[model samples]
Target: MRRAARARIDLNALRHNLSVARAAAPGSRVMAVIKADAYGHGMREAARALAGLSDAFAVSCVQEAAVLREAGITQPLVVLQGFKDDAELVEVVRLDAQTVLHEPGQLACLESSHLETPPAVWLKLDTGMHRLGFAPVEAAALVQRLRTGDLVAGHPGLMTHLACADEPARPESETQLRAFDEAVAGLPGEQSIANSAAVLRMPAAHRDWVRPGIMLYGASPLIGVSAESMGLRPVMTVGAPVVAVKPLRPGDAVGYGGTYVCERPRTLAIVAIGYGDGYPRHAPSGTPVLVRGHRCPLMGRVSMDMLGVDVTDVPDVRVGDMATLWGEGLPVDEIAEVAGTISYELLCSVGGRLQAEYVES
Candidate 1:
């Protein structure tokens, strides 16, 4: 069946983006983050595409790691959240996956686990991001314990999350980096503090391993900087066909609740994509969409399975013409701005119902 709406996953672009991350952090090992299904690009497929290039793969949990393992991915898998319980710890050990011990409870779980051979562990320090990890003061003690503990396979690496790396002007990243350095003073093992933004901007934070998430999927982590500016190529392009075209007279309202009223006679092309297909429902009129490779303004509310785009200025618009919601010519960030959201949400929210086609080149 020919699907009217589809998401094209460019594997080559994915590879290119990874290279960009690597280039930014030339000395650091790359842990390609494929969590949230590689931000909705399909987990196993992304793992396969990056298997040879990426030094390691990082996921949100052990289950995601198991998925990669089941798919025959041999690269080291790092569970960012670590094991939730003893059972998960066992599974982590069984799969030979590395786990991040973010809290005392996770450490306790690991200590109590009966697994004869525990997987390698990374100790997460709560430098400034209060969301996870042990306190900076507590990091040294935990590292000491992990070093002597039976559960850890080798010298555990140290890591921390950056709270404001995206905002380059902010001092929060520097604060976090200083705290991390102080916390891990005189400590053995590798260090990792740079995320996508830090990998690109903060050279001092680029430690032994750098975890690049959204950047690997071709989205910029920093504000005022574009992915293209960072030499990153978009990996996903959402395309749908125009299903119908209507010529509306002046004062004609379009879509539900008549939210958008046309002031001038215009040609509106109904596209076979909508909130149901992960297009943001809150996207306001004037959001940009590409019709016949020309920019067109989105009109009216995005419905469940269709959206209206003003294609009057776009020449040769017709039924079955391709309309790009985001990606390629149209940046997802622009659409996200119109939707009053972020590119992360838009990319991750790509609907499961949309057919995904993977391209190598």
Candidate 2:
């Protein structure tokens, strides 16, 4: 807890974000995506915080699901990426986690298993992402096969992922949705397609289930917009402490690579966070960071353990002053933009070393 770097998660903000998803996609069951440790906000803690609010928990692997189960979280979990080996086959059943079957070998694995029970399976259709899931024709055939094979007698669902829903104006959104519809036509089970982007933009895609990932963490999928713009709040504030203070002369470069030259004599504060802690290395000079509630421009190449910021405008900024990388009043989207990525990457890439402080409203 004494470390200069930390990420404080607002458990209440996480709850509020889930509430927002529930309201946005009314009448549909909500499955909160907690993969990558709830996008690096701590899986068990985030699952515990959202235990009652979420209809189900979703993670990428059985290990993540087991963490929730160990914490007494009994909500049904759907593995976004299905099993890798037969060992997971038993774990899926034992953990009672559902899985998305996207490969031919997975179906064979399920068919070969003689266990008394098989975990519920969600058929994943490629739709348009083309990353995972079966082709439209193959997906249809697989669904029929599962229905006939008794592989998922108790529960079954159809799920698809969106690649361009974040850009509402992109034609791929509708194309993917239509492809998913055609693939699952006449299938007698629940349907899910929307991620945070679709939930906020493509209402028609909101079907029986809404799998919201980034939105649950209170960050926007679309650039230059926020949940508040859509009536939501940010959940996590990655904070660090000012470790060093130095006065820089005009034209003097600030950090390694000398990419940033001091425009004027200014006091620069070095924050104890950098690419090693998952702060983007691509973050160019002049990227904004919050110090003492004042906006300061990040003024150098991000190093392994520290980054320099121009704090000339921030009154009373000193060593050990709290600097907010994002959250609270700071918009994560703004920081993510400076990092040349989306909020999702910034949130998920935060390393495990950062101490997480969960604050319930």
Candidate 3:
């Protein structure tokens, strides 16, 4: 018998979330961000599912873009981080992938590395994120530089990352938007400003293009909002089978560090998943896991390959019964909250130990 965790990927749910983004910003073009292996939902499958719906696709690097090209994804692909060196720049051109020029060195590389045909490029403006992009004040000069450069395409698209779009009440997004607008004022080419949060909450940031990342995977982008309320369905439903069961008395301790002491007569269902299988090791006791469609509280500490859950309330609980870690009936956000992390970390951290099951429905 196997003791590995499993992730059920629903392609329909992915498409539905993409539709939500599109519906939120009907005027702007959709650049579906499929980086980090489509945020651990399988990049190839996600690309195939939303091929016709998205105007473009985005990945962190050129290698990821090549994967989509090889999988017969014909839509325009944008390399979000862009090429780091000439070799990657060559591959970007060969794969016909668009790239972002965020710094002077990258522009210098582009100018030095001449190709037969220039790929489309996006100029990142560092309005406030300060991670990538050039100084917002230099937006006009940067645009002029790209337009006048030998290796640039027809026109470089203008884009910037939002610093606090998730916190809609914060003024940072407004500040960033204002800076981006002032920097690229009357500048040539398309402007992209909104991310997933901006797409759903901050409508004013929606410009020429909108990039949606986590929302496409059916995870909530807002802090307190649920994905279901935003018309999104969970795409990656993860679970593991119960391998062993044990009865504990009121004073009985469980798992490592004896973090949980039984308060009453309890039946514990030991699950076949833990930190080793990408289940958050920090998820403490009381974190909910769905067993037989009933919510069971996780007990004690999580080990490398196993975790214990209080299944006393579950009637007819037995070994080999499935216990859902997240997704399906259990929202990943709930688990993330208890673990003190984000849904993105959980999704991307799914290790090879767990088997991935992709389904159409």
lDDT winner among the candidates?
3
Note the Cα lDDT for every prediction shown.
Answer: 0.90, 0.85, 0.91
lDDT of 1 at 198: 90
Residue 291, candidate 1: alpha-carbon lDDT: 91
Would you estimate the TM-scores of all the predictions? 0.98, 0.96, 0.98
Sorted on lDDT, highest at the top, how do the candidates line up? Answer: 3, 1, 2
Residue-level lDDT of model 2, residues 142-249, one tens digit each, is 776786757775546888899998788889989988898887788778899999888888889999999999988888876556667877788888999999998899
Candidate 2: Cα lDDT at 43: 90
lDDT of 1 by residue, 106-191 (tens): 88777776777868999988888899988898877887787775668878999999999999899998999889899899999999
Cand. 2 TM to true fold: 0.96
User: How many clashing pairs in candidate 3?
Assistant: 0
Q: lDDT by residue for model 3 over 79-164, one digit each (tens)? A: 99999999999999989999999988899988887789887899998988889999988878877777775568888999999988
Candidate with better lDDT, 1 vs 3:
3
